[model samples]
Target: MESVVLDEIDLSLIHALTIDGRAPFSRIAAVLGVSDQTVARRYRRLRRADVIRVVGRLDARRLGHVVWALRLRVAPGSANAVARALAKRPDTSYVQLASGGTEVLCGTEASSEHDHAQLLEQLTETRPVLAISAQCVLHVFRGGPAAWPALTTALDPGQAARLDPYPGVAPSEVVLDDGDRALLDALSVDGRAAHATIAHATGWHESTVRRRIDALRSAGALFVDVDIDERLLGVHANTLLLMSVAPAALSSVGEALAEHEQVAFAGATTGATNLVASLMCADVYALYDYLTDRLAAIPAISSIETVPIVRTIKRGSIFGG
Candidate 1:
């Protein structure tokens, strides 16, 4: 596929959306000093090219669900099939073929111990499976509800401030009722879907829809994220780093890694390798530089395993039909 060339306006628009996925075209235009029609047209063209999308995702942890990162070493020649199957499952996201197409890495949400067990059983029974390691995410230093800084750097501070949404409310326990589910279902498909459209789908008034969405965001129960093809930004290497860090320095190392511009996601997890990070780099050489210079500078890292992702089948979870 031909890579889409993003101009300055396109980059700024993407950065604006990352700040507020549902920001009106007029508002984004004002920030970028472009006409509303131009902003809307560029967005449509990008969407049509499958270069970018906005999705609303629920933070399962707020609802008492466990999020897991799974690494499955499958039989040769089966990674693609396995990844596609995993991507089709609604619970899985960031499904990818990695480690020379013999391994599949994905993130899943399990609502209960039984659900987690059932997923493990299913994977163990699948013919292509060879080995599996499931790591529960203990804490997320970055990623998931956080925009990638590399992508968002196009906008100047003033422009970003204008586009920034209000701060989220304090974290609190959130329970999902049927109405919330319906509203989230519509958002999963299009985070920028109009409130009136969502209300019609959910059988609620537009005002109610707006109120519910605001409440969800403020409570940290939901977030709108930008999903973009990295190739559009000249990213050619996507690698996952699994590291064993000194127990005493884990927090510092994780925090430091989260600040790196090349890192798209970094988190502490429960497993042999306590810290995991996903990197988007310009090329393999860039990745090498990161490993040798940036990563090597961190004395806390004892060992590292680099898995170059071959492809990403899905970027985020989508709820409902």
Candidate 2:
């Protein structure tokens, strides 16, 4: 890894985009008090460095899908191989090699009982995979751009309002039609893609494209996530926290962790350890402080296990779609 310098302006730009990934450069410039060209230049620099990406994703729950986190003990020297294979699958996301490169951790989504069974069967039958444990994510407390407090804090209320996309009401049991799927496929590739471009791809009028996008957003069927390389944010440590909490206090502890700025995401899961959290910190010392001061305050927590992620093989997405 090489040293990267990010000034306050860069941070502000990132924060603004996290609020709205497709925000106009002029809008961002006005908020940050910089020229649009400067913001554009900085965006290009960051993109070239692979330090950040803006991606659109379908809400798994709305799509009738359930998410699973898998912990795998792989055969020696087979960890990277197995990880790459898993990464190539559209269902798996956030694949990483951990635990001395012999353990693989990743998330995948299953739409049905058959889908879930096939996934388990595929991995268990694989020769390189020795043991596996899969935890079904029951509910997401906080995740995606909406939960990144550090980025949002750079702007005051007024500035944030200027960049806000003003998404609409959440929908219940909103199933995806073919047109919806086509539109989502376009967005999954590039969250910031122009309306005209998406229209061309989906064979719909630009106005229709915009309308569908707004509808999906309002219905809570989609989200725009700005994926920043935490390393570039001076946060070099990303750890998975598996926690066991008293069943009665599960919601309390999970909600508390979700509010912590250091927490990238937290969820309640099905397993012996019912709560799972992904945390990012400036360094090991910062992570220790978070665990001791913030996490220790949660009296319901009975146990915690931490694992450092060595590499991100694939961002959770559909298998090679």
Candidate 3:
């Protein structure tokens, strides 16, 4: 695919969508000081070019699902096949070939005990699999529903405020039904889908669809996220940092990493490494600087293992093109 050259308007539009993926074009236009037609056209062009995609994702924690980060070491020359197979599973997301094509890293959401056991069984039985490690996400300091600051910085505070729709507190004891599942299926494909379109897919009235979605968002069970090609933002290097931190300073270190612009995702997990973070940089040199400078400044880190991602096969349950 050819690269899409983005100007200020394009960048601002992306920022606006990141703030509220389902925000009406007219509302975005008002904040951007452009016509509704211009905003719509720009979005269409970007979507067609695969520059940006809006997807609705269910919050596993809010839904009482367990999220696991998996690292699989495979025999030489089997990384791509292993990664692709993992990506095909509905429960897996963020599947990537990393560590010089010797390992596969991915995240999976298990909704039940059976699902969790099944995943482990499948991984253990897969041929050529040398080793496997699974980490249960204990706490998420950032990532998931949180938008990365790299694209969000294009909009000033005032503009961002105008585009932001206040998210109300989650209701206690939320649950999902068949209708909700159907609605989410449609939204996972196009978060910006019109109410009528979603209604058609879910066999619900448009008003019901709207109310259900609003309720889900309010309960923090559903969130809309913007997925873009990082290369378009000049991100040439992606690495995962697995660090063993002092247990006493784990929260502090994870919070500090979340504040870094280069850090896309940071969290605390149960594994050999207590802290795991994903970094996106302009180049390998920038990554090295972050490692030796910013990261080294933190005294809590006892050990660091850098895994450079070779290819990302999936993102947030959606396969990458």
TM-score computed on alpha carbons, candidate 3: 0.94
Instruction: Write one digit per residue (lDDT tens) for candidate 2, span 1-321.
Output: 335688888888888887788788998999899999999999988888877777787678877788888999999999999999997886775788886978999888787879989999999999999999988888887774354676667778888887878744446566778777677778877888999999999999999999988877767677777777777767878788999999899998888987998887788899889999888898889989988998998889999999988788775431111
TM-score of each: 0.94, 0.91, 0.94
Q: Give per-residue CA lDDT, model 1, range 53-126, as digits (tens).
A: 89888877678888899999999999999999998886785798885779999898887889999999999999
lDDT of every model, 2 decimals: 0.85, 0.81, 0.85
lDDT score, candidate 3, position 5:
86
Deviation in Å, model 1, residue 255 alpha carbon: 0.7
Candidate 2 TM-score, true structure as reference: 0.91
Candidate 3 weakest ten by summed lDDT: 312-321
Cα displacement (angstroms), candidate 1, residue 115, comes to 2.0
Identify the runs in model 1 with alpha carbons over 4 angstroms from their true place.
Answer: 1-3, 317-321
Q: Would you list the rank order by lDDT, best first?
A: 1, 3, 2
Task: Report RMSD (Å) for each prediction in the order shown.
Answer: 2.5, 2.7, 2.4
- Compared with the true structure, the alpha-carbon lDDT of candidate 3 equals 0.85
Native-vs-model 1 lDDT? 0.85
